[model samples]
Every structure is written in C-alpha cells, then in structure tokens.
Target: MLLIVGAGFAGLSAALRARHLGVAVTVVAGRERAFDAPECLSLEGVRALHDCGLDARQLQLPPVREYISRWGESPMLSRAPPPGIPKNIMLGRVQLLRALRACATEEGVTFVEADELYRVLPTRQGLQLQFTGPVQELVLDASFAIDASGRAAVLARKLGVGRRTFDHLVAYGVRGPVHGLPEGVVHTFSVADGWVFAVSDSPGQAHVCFYTNGRLAGRVTEAKIMERVPYQIRSLMSDEDMWLASGVSAANASTSLLDVPGGTYWLACGDALQTVDPLSSSGITTALQQGAAAVSAAVASLSGNLEPMRAYWLESRAHFDSYVRNRNSFYGFGESAS
Candidate 1:
C-alpha cells in the first residue's frame, strides 16, 4: 500500500501513478477543495499538459492566451500567439480540484475529504499519519510516503529535513474582473521594492500581485498590501474580489527559500520542497511536474525498484535550484553568506 498526504496536484498525481502500478494508494487531502494561487493555471499551464499528451480536454480546462504587463509603460504587449493552442479557457482551482478528484475516483483510489494531517510518524511498519477532525487515527502501512502538503513541510519537519533561505521575496495579490483589460498578456514590472504582475484569462478575474523586498516586511501586512495595488486599477474591481476582503494589505508571508534535505521514507514537492520568486510564474507547473515525478518514485519503490527515488530527488533539485541561482544572479542579488 502507498500513502499520500495532501491531495493537491502533487498528491493527486502520486495517487494516480501508484494505482497504475497496481499499488493500493490512499490520499488524505487537507481541504475539500484544491486552492491554486489565482491565475497559476493559465494557458501556458494547460499547454504544458497538452504537449505532454495529457488532454486538457479530458480535464475540461479553458484555453489560456497571451500574457501582458504594465510598469512605466502604458498598455501591455501580448506574447507571440502560438498556433493550435486552446482558446481563452482557464479552469478555476475548484474545477481543477474536481477533475483530479473525478480521475482518482474513476481509477479506484481512496480519497478522504476535509482531512488535515498534523504529523506523520515512521513506525516499524510503514507510516502512521495523524489527522484532525472526523477522520480516525489510522496507521497506514506503505513502502514510501509522498508529502504534497504545500509549504507547511508537515512531513519534512517531522523527519528533520533542513531548509535553506535563498533570498527575500514578498507578494500581495487579489483576483477580480479587469475592465478593458487586454487578454493574453502577463505584465511584469520591477519596482523600487520588488515587482508586480498583472495576468488575464483567469477564472472570471484578473489577478494582480506585487512582490517586494523583505526589508519592508513590516509595512507589507494584510491591511497594507492592497495599498500596493495601483489605484488606476482598483476601481475596476468589485467588492467581492478574492483576497480583497481578506485584508487591505497582506505580506507575502512566505520565507523566500528552498528545501533540499533528504529523508528515508519522505519526499517533498512544490512549494513544500522549494519556493521560488513569483517572477517565474512556474510554481504550478513545477508542482504538477514534481507531483508526477514523486508518484513515479513511490511506484518504483513499491515494485522493488528503489533507484527512482534518488533520480526523482536529483532531477527535482536540479530544476528548482538552478532557477533560484539564476534568478538571484539576474537580479544582482547576492548569494547566501552561508
């Protein structure tokens, strides 16, 4: 049996892969719904899946167009329009969650709803996962465990995995309809503090976020984050915009860093393993890919093929670590003094 914690993209992918290998897989999703950072599932994301032979049609996701941005400039520019791409289709986090859930159900994998995992203990027999709420304190026996619980590092912390802070990056974001907004453009700008982005073709909303420096963390609180959203666009949003009601200004509240520590029965994926600056806009893509990769490793281990775990670790680190180093260098940020 294979046990997976957190049924986000990585967890969902792992569960599917394990079932394909004839391994019994059970997933405990933290929330009933998957929460994708708004606009993280743009056309570029769908295109990646389509290009990999996973039919975006199968998941019923919308088409993502070009990207746009505005800083010192006026209107933003659209990306080079690509052919054969799906038109203006974008799936909300909820829809994506639904699709993955349906896939798992159809494949006969067990999914427990509203399941929040507090800790994972390694016993003589597989892993013992403790849950909060209505779920029982069940101990699952499996050859390996995949931790896809996002940045919380639930398993990483329990297993003593060490994390490293790369650079200081902060972002405040909200979602809403952008009146007269240009479609197909992901606009980015470098500010004195950090940067901001405006992306279109979102799930009925345009997403905007400002990334700032850690030095001003105190001023970037939830009550102040919205102040960072430009006034020229504030009127275009409605009162019901996501994250708008949460607070006026919200600090990014994330430690800008990467975690590369290894464990005997645990592996990390997505932001749980490493968090790069949002400038890359590849967080969701990398998460989906890492989830799939982690599943591959677990399946291999179950089939008496243990080498896949090593390969999975090395490959995942190479991509994320390279991105971190390159971003720091491009922005003239100094390497960690450590």
Candidate 2:
C-alpha cells in the first residue's frame, strides 16, 4: 500500500495514477489547501489530464481562444499557437480539485480525513502515519509515503527533510466583480517596472495578480505594478478598482526546491519538491506531471528496476534547469513588477 499526504492537484493525480497502475493508494487530507488561486492550463497540461483519463470540458473548463501579451516596450502582440500546439485554458483551482476528488472517490481510493499529520513513526517494513483530526485519531502504515501537500510539505517536514529557498518571489492577487474581457481570454503585459496577469475568472468576475519579491510587497501600488500599459490593454481590463477590494490576497510564488526530494521509502512530488514562478503559467501542469512521474519511477523500482528513483530525480532536476532558463530569458526584459 502507498500513502499520499495531500489532496491537491499532485496528490490526487498520484492517487489516480496509482489506481491505474494497480497499486492501492490512501490519501491523507492534511490541512486544507486554499484553492482560490487562478491558473491557466497549458496545452501540455490538457494532455496530462487526458493521460489521466479526465475530460476538462465535462469539468466546465473554459477553453482559451487567444493570448495577448506585451513586454518591456515591445509591441502589443496577439499570438497563435505554432503548428500542432493546442490551446491552453483558464482553470479554477477549486474546480479542478473538486473534479479530481470526485474521480478519486469513484475509483475507490480510500481517503483518511485528518486536519494534519500528527506523527510519523518509522518501522522496519515501512512508515507508520499518524494524524489527529477534529473527529478522531487515526494511524496507518504504508510501504511508502509521498509528500504531495503542496508548499506545506507536511510529511517531508516530519521526516526532517530540509528545503532550499532561492528567492522570496510572491504574487499579490485580487479576485472580484469586474467587467469587459471576453470569456476565455488570457492576458499578460509587462510595464516599465513589472508585469500584470489577468483572466476572466467567470461571468462578471475577473482575477488579477502581479509578481514581485515578497520583501517589497508593502510598497506595491497599482501604478508601479501596472504603469504604461497601453489603452488597448487597459480597455480589455479595468483593474484599477481591484486594489480597493478587501478580497485582496497574496500567494507564495517563490522559486524553491527540496534539498533532498526522496529517500529509500519516501518521496516528495509537486510543489513539495519544487516550486516555480507562476509567470510560467504551468503550475498545475507541473504538479500533475510530477505526481505521475514520481509514481512511474516507484512502480519501475518496485519491479526490480535499477535505482529508478535516482533516475527520476535527475530528470526532475533537468526539467527545473530548463524551466529556469526559459523563465530567465522571458524575465530578462526587466525585474519583476515589484
């Protein structure tokens, strides 16, 4: 049996994939994760869901029709996918998890309701998991445990694993009533000092967020973060009012990674393993891919394959390196809108 420590995109993905691989999986619903963040599922992400046997249309996802982007004095550009690249879609984090959880239940994946993990005791055969929720105390043992609890890294932290923080990047966001942008349109633009990303969250609603070093969030303002954006862009999104909404919030957008992603009997996947900038616009996809990748290595090793876990780690690192190069090149225009 295998235990996964989250119910977010990655944990749920791992659970679904485990079932597909004929492995029994139990998901620990550790402290609830906030699912209000806005996300855009890339073409790659759509395929990942397809590989997991999920249908986004049935999940009520809005397919993106176009993307408008501009950066650092560059001309405003409306670009189309090249060749076979499929279109990306705007995704609601909450809606995605709800769909994943529904599928997991239908597939008979056992879910242990718990507030957070209490204690982890190591035994000869495997790991003993403990948790105390508002309802009761519970314990379970598994041959392996996965920390897919997103940024919390619950199980990893309990295992005494350490993480390395490379920077304090964060996204300050606002979601509420707004009008003007057509449904299924995703927009991003870089100003003289920063960048702004906006999506039509739903009918009569919009979500806007900006990335910057967390150390400077206190002095952030609409003008500094959204300056010099063309009227063409401004006409599409009237973001000036979002700043006054008490609904304003902040989410960690830091670029960090675990010092050690796994051990002989456990591993961390998704954000618990590595977190990239939201500017990449592929957070959900990365989590889903990591979950499946981690489990693939686990299954191969279980079948007497040679050190597949190490091989998986190397592949993961290489992916991160590639992501960094792309992100740096895009950000080369200027520092974050902070």
Candidate 3:
C-alpha cells in the first residue's frame, strides 16, 4: 500500500494514478480549505487535467484568450493568443480541488482527513503515520509514502533533506467583486515597486494580487495597490466588496534531493520538491506531472527496480534548474526595463 500525504492536486493525482496501477493507496489531507485564491490553468495544465479524467469545459471556468499589460506608465499593450495554443482557463482554486477530490473518490481512493500529522515512523516493514484530528486518532502503515504536503515538505524535512530559497519575494492579494474588467483576459500592471495582476474568475468576482520584494510587501496596503493599478481598475473597487490580504513567498525554492527516492521507501513531489515563481504559471501543471511520475516511481521501486526513482530525481532536479534560469531572466527583464 502507498500512503500519500496532502489531498491537493498533487496528492490526488498520485492517489488516482497509483490506484490505476492496481496498488492500494490512501490519501491523508489536512482539514484546511483549499480555496485560498484564484488560479489560471494554462493549456498544458488543462491537458493534464483532461488526462486525469477532468473535463475543463464541464467546470464552466472562464477561458482567457488574451492578456493586457501596462508597464510603468507605458500605454497598455494587448497580447493575442499564439497560434496552436489552447485556450487557458481561470477558475477558483478551491473549486478545482473539490472537483479533483471527488474524482479521486470515484476512483476508489481512500481519503483520511486530519487536522495534523503527529508522527511518521519508519519501521522494518514500512512507514507508519499517526494523525490527530477532531474525531479520533488514526494510524496508517504503508510500504511507501509520497510527501505531497507542498512547501511544508513534511516528510522531506523530517528526513533531514534541506531546501533552498532563491529569492525574497512575497505576494499579497485579495478576492472580491470587481467590475469594469474584461471577462476572459488577465490584466497586469507593473509599478515602480512591484507588479499587480487582476483577473475575473466569474461574472463579477475577481482576484487581484501584488508581487513585490519582501521588505516592501510588509508595508503594502490595499489602498496602495489600488493607487498603483490603472484608473479603470481603481474605479471598480466597491466599498461594499470585502478584501483580505495575506503574503507568501513568490520566490523560487527547491528541496535538496540527496535523500529523496531513498531506498525505495519514500519520495516527494509537487511543491514538496520544488516551487517556481507564479509568473511561470506552471505550478499546477508541474504538480500534476510530478504526482503522476511519483506513482510510476513508486510502482517501479516496489517491483525491486529502483532505476525509475533515480531517473525521476534527476529529472526533477533538471526541471528546477531550468525553471530558475527562466525565472531569473524574466525578472531581470522587468528590472532592466524599469
């Protein structure tokens, strides 16, 4: 049996794929709601979802065909979708998680919802997990474990694997009713201090965020962000529309893979392994891909062939390195232009 931690896209994908491989899989996730913000589903992400048996069209997500950007007082620049590129969709993050979880359930994947992971002990036969929640205590033993607990890297950190953060960027945002915005286009404005992005996920509801260095982010208020945005966006903010702001690292970070794919017993995927800047717009796609790859690695390792796990580690490392390089280039361009 395989134990997957966290029930987000990564963990659910891993659970579903492992079940398809005829393996017994159980997913343990915290009780926290997944609806933190809005997310954009790129063409690649949409394909991944479809491969996982999700129909994006059936979800009724808004399709984005273009993007409008304004950089530091420059005139608005309109970008058309590139040929052969599939339409990208924007939807509420929580809604997608719920859909994925429902699909996993339909696939016969067991889900254990807990408030916290109390302990993980590796024993002679396999690994044992102890979880605490509102109802009662539960323990699970499995031959292998997949750490899809995201940036927390629960198992990785406990195993003494280290992580590296490449930048000190932070993003703060709010979600509320926003008017006077195009339905299917993302609007971005580059300010002197940082950048702001706004997109309407539904008819009237939207998500807006400001990405800035940590120091400035600490002092960035909603009013300040409103001032930085274009007049059209600023004018649409209604006093009755609620706003809330929270900050998280927008930097590139990755865990050192020294002990990952270790001895065919444990591995990490998704944000647990590496995280890219939001500008790359690859988080969900990368997470789903890694989740599927983790299942393949787990299946191969259980069969006494460790080659696939090793290869997966190398591939994950290479992907992170390439992502970092591209992220740096993109940020550098914005800085130079400013």
State the lDDT at 49 in candidate 1.
51
Whole-model lDDT values for every prediction: 0.62, 0.74, 0.72
TM-score (C-alpha, index-matched) for candidate 2: 0.86
Question: Over the stretch 203-268, how does candidate 3's per-residue lDDT look in tens digits?
Answer: 776677767666554576555655555454465555433553322223322223334534448888
Question: Which of 1 and 2 is ahead in TM-score?
Answer: 2
Sort by TM-score, top down from the best: 2, 3, 1
For candidate 2, the per-residue lDDT at 77 reads 18
On lDDT, who's better, 1 or 3?
3
Candidate 3 lDDT at 212 equals: 63
CA lDDT, candidate 3, residue 267:
87
Q: Give the 10-residue window scoring lowest on summed lDDT in candidate 1.
A: 73-82
Enumerate residue pairs that collide in model 2: 194-337
Instruction: Provide the TM-score for each candidate, comma-separated.
Output: 0.78, 0.86, 0.85
Model 2, range 119-175, lDDT digits (tens) per residue? 999988678988887688878888888889898898888888888876677676766
Tens digits of per-residue lDDT for model 1, 33-86: 443444445466666454333566776443445544344421211222223323
